[model samples]
Target: MNMMGSLVALLVALIWKPDFEEWRLGWDIKLFARIFSGIVISGMAFAVIVWCVDANGPVFVSMFRPVRLVVVVIVASLILQEPIYSGSIIGTVILVGGLYLVLWAKKKEMKSMSNPVETNRTDRNVV
Candidate 1:
């Protein structure tokens, strides 16, 4: 989705003002290194995410997406010196609640699967 949006924006830019000069940001070593670092980190992160998705199904892997929001709230407040918004707090709470629910449901499912079902419910009916 992100890549598709970026490509669409690039296409629009080409149609609006076709200028190859816009791509030529005078090559500074720092700028090149920064871009390189970002690509490397992004690639590594993507590889790890792919590996996780393969090892664990998408449902289990997807639950971690909300964790990024919690991290962002902290970093935004502390590093960026931004005020903590009520929306951020609310979102964090919801994310945490969702995580707990998913974990609980998964655990319950595992437990139910692990224990064998008793078809002889005549004995259980007495209780």
Candidate 2:
């Protein structure tokens, strides 16, 4: 975080040679508070995502990507009053199909492991 912040600061310093007056945050407490709150909420959400990965395993995170697409479509159409394009519909179909394929493959893998020859005793945990 520090390194990224420093790199961004350096970039801005090089690109925009501003005076101290402009650099100051000023007395816009409401805007500052809203921005700070957003940062905190985002951090909390990220922490929750980490916990989900730890609990459900890493592959679980990938499952949510397609859902994000659905959310974007809904938010754009409803909130922004934007029209949904045919391309977005096609992409959603593709995403759903791909997710189904992955789930089917994972099921097949587990089913095959049911055979005595493939079974092995281990201390691995499963949910």
Q: Provide TM-scores for the models.
A: 0.70, 0.59
Score candidate 1 by TM-score against the native.
0.70
Report the error of model 2 at residue 75, Å: 1.2
Q: Write the per-residue lDDT of candidate 1 for residues 56-82, one digit (tens) a residue.
A: 667777899889989999998999999
Worst 10 residues of 2 by lDDT: 18-27
Cα error of candidate 2 at position 56, Å: 1.7
Task: Give residue 21's error in model 1 in angstroms.
Answer: 6.7
**Candidate 2 steric clashes:** 0
Q: What is the lDDT of residue 114 in candidate 2?
A: 79
lDDT of 2 by residue, 1-127 (tens): 8689879987898679656665556569977897887799879978988998998566657776687998899799999999999998998888888888887886777678775475567867966
Worst 10 residues of 1 by lDDT: 118-127
Error of 1 at 42 (Å): 2.1
